[model samples]
Target chain A: MQYLNNIGTYFLMIIELFRKPTKWSVMRHLILKDIDDLIIGSLGIVSFIAFFVGGVVTIQTALNIDNPLIPKTLVGFATRQSILLEFAPTFMSIIMAGKVGSFITSSIGTMRVTEQIDALEVMGINSLNYLVFPKLVAMAFYPFVISIAMFLGIIGGLTACVYGGYSSVDDFITGIQQDFQPFHIVYAFIKTFLFAFVLATIPSYHGYYMKGGALEVGEASTTSFVWTSVTIILLNYLATQLLLS
Target chain B: MIEVKNLHKSFGDAHILKGISNTFEQGKTNLIIGQSGSGKSVFLKCLLGLYDYEEGSIEYNGEVFANLSEDKKRDMRAKIGMVFQGSALFDSLTIEENVMFPLRMFTKLKKDEMRERASIVLKRVNLEDAHKKMPSEASGGMQKRVAIARAIVNNPKYLFCDEPNSGLDPKTAIVIDNLIHEITEEYNITTVINTHDMNSVMEIGDSIMFLKDGLKAWEGSKKTIFKTDNKIVTDFVYSSNLFKKVREAVLKEQG
Candidate 1:
């Protein structure tokens, strides 16, 4: 029942978010600011995690397939498949639910605790539209972050395969190309886009409606992170069932 | 002028405002004073349309707020400006940017024109020299001044200030009080202040409403509050010995 309530409130918030829009001139600045905060600010952590996770995938695949009958190039295939299908999109998004999600929650929650949101509402500004819409628009570019992740992941896998004696550079490169399906990349990005919207809005819901003061802001951020990660996982499962299965 | 008639508000099982009815005159600093949990903030928020009322009407220049369409309500809200207790300045913006925000959002003025208008208000609040600083860098008094500058930058018809002097020194509090008074008179804006600052009450509270436990305990001017025998209003106002002596001296002067 609580889950149902949350889902209902989340949808209602989305409805309110699109109404009474801020002026485009104002929205443009807000979107730019959010892009800077949510996207540009997230690049370093995404890159670090992607590279290391991709390397681990390559090493794990190579060690598990010790049989000579299995082609060494399968290491690269497994690495690319795992990175694109799961690591880059789903797993990295879980990280974002912590990084970007907490950011949105804490900032907006602080604003609420401080009466900044009230000031906006009293000024006739739609605080929801003013605070959340820009994030939704900015998250439309979530693919850019995933694109970086995909690039770094593949590079890290290639480096790992060559240096770790898992496979020769040529075989790994060949494996990456052998059955390269563009649609899988599309599938990954479709999930990325969906999760991006999830990441932007769920935390906003927790923060915007949060009550109490400074301590409550911390609690709200934690709750937002937990809920965002949980929702992303659920949506990932649902999307994969529909898109992949 | 703003008027509230038989106002009542509640949250779940808790009633916060009980039948509050009063008029806050234009061109004057109208104050609502009460101890914590006395519903002054709730009353002010109801007037601002930040909170919905269970029963009653809040009117601005005779336009019934509850009956207005969303568009109409928004239009009414645009005519209002508010100073939050914490000043509520946008953390990301410099003082100048904070003051220019409403103009940037609501008007189509050119960049230079917006800057010029922001400068004019900033100067009005005596914040010209602190324009480039962030809200965090400014003193509490300066932040309050910046808030005032932002609130009036759009030339609102009604100004709502929630404890504008909450964190200021007594001297600075009086300065802020006087500033609001001057602005209210100059713009003919109906200014409503929610505060428990006795200094403010005695200084610029042209009209004062005292609340006790969600009910209107007393309503009178600064002069009448001194002459009245209402213990609820007097006890809260004179709780401190210094203020008690001040009130006794005032009554003696009156006698």
Candidate 2:
């Protein structure tokens, strides 16, 4: 019942968030700052993680093929498929659910604790729009981040496959291009966009409505990350079943 | 001027503010003073339209607040400034940007113009040299002064403060109270402050409203509060030993 109530309030907040548009001059600065915080700032970790994890996934896939009859090209195919289908779009988002989600929650939660939200309200600003909308706008660029992850993951996998002697570079390239479908990219990006929305909003919901003091801000951040990851996983399943199946 | 008539607020079977009525005059420091849990904060929130009451009406300049449309309400709110208990400065921004926030939100002034306007208010609050500093680097008194600068930068007609001096030393608290008082008179704003600080009460309680268990128990000014015989008001006001002696000294002097 409480979950239902929270869901209802979340939708209402989304509605209210778009209603009173803040002056674009202020919103422009806010949006750029959010892009810097949520997107550009995330590039370093995303690149490092994507590269190393892709190598690990390739090495693992190469080892799993003990059947001597299996083609060497299959290693590259599996790496490409995994990186594009789930690793880049879904798994990377779970990582962001920790990084970006906690940031939104704690920053906004601290503002609530310090009565900055009330100050905005008393100033007649729609605190929701002022605080959350820019984040939403910035997260629209989440696909850009995922694209980098996808590119780096494939590069990492190619390096592992060729250096590990699991497959020749030409065979891996052929495997990557053998059955490529453009729609797979579209589907992955669709999931990325939906997860981006979830990442921006679920954390904001926790932070904006959080009560108590500093202790609760930490708690809200944990809860928000859990909820964001849960929502992204659920949405991934639903989107796959609906779009791919 | 702001007027509240029989304002009532409740929270899920807990009646917080019950039929409280008062008029806060313009150009003066109007205070709502009460013990903890007496609904003083709730009353101020209701006046600021942060909380909606179930009954009665709140009027600003003779226009009923609850009757205004959403757009009109927002426009009215833009004319009102608030200083929060924690000084609520945007931690990420420099002091100058914090003061310039309202202008950016509500006006089309160029960046230089906004900076100039922000400087004027920062200077007014004696923070001219602190523009590049962040809120985290500021002392408690400096933060309070920055809050005052932010509150008045937009030239609001009404100003509301929630415990404007909660965590400061006695001297700094008095300084904040005096700043609010001076700004109230200077801007002719309808200022409403919710506080229990005895120093603030004695220093700038131009028109004071005493709330007891969510009801208005007494009403008077700084001088009149010193002489009030209402037991509820007297008990709460003179509970501290120092204020008790001060009250007795004032009474003896009068006699």
Q: Give the root-mean-square deviation of each candidate in angstroms.
A: 1.3, 1.0
What would the TM-scores of all predictions be?
A: 0.97, 0.98
Computed on C-alpha atoms, the DockQ of candidate 2 is 0.87
Could you give the DockQ of candidate 1? 0.86
* lDDT (Cα, tens digit) per residue for candidate 1, span A1-245: 98798789889999999999999988899999999999999999999988988898898898899789999889888888998998999999999999999999999999999889988998888899999999999999999999999889989999988999888999999888878899998899999999999999999999999999999999999999998898889999998999988
Query: Which DockQ values do the candidates obtain, in the order shown?
Result: 0.86, 0.87
Compose the digit string of candidate 1's lDDT tens values, residues B109-150.
998998999999989988778879999999999999999999
Candidate 1 wrong stretches, greater than 4 Å? none
Q: Write the per-residue lDDT of candidate 2 for residues A1-245, one digit (tens) a residue.
A: 99999999999999999988888878999999999999999999999999989888889999999998988888888988999999999999999999999999999999999999998898889999999999999999999999999999989999998999988999888878878999999999999999999999999999999999999999999999999999999999999999999
- The pairs that clash in candidate 1 are none
Over the full model, what C-alpha lDDT does candidate 2 score relative to the true structure?
Answer: 0.93
TM-score of 1: 0.97
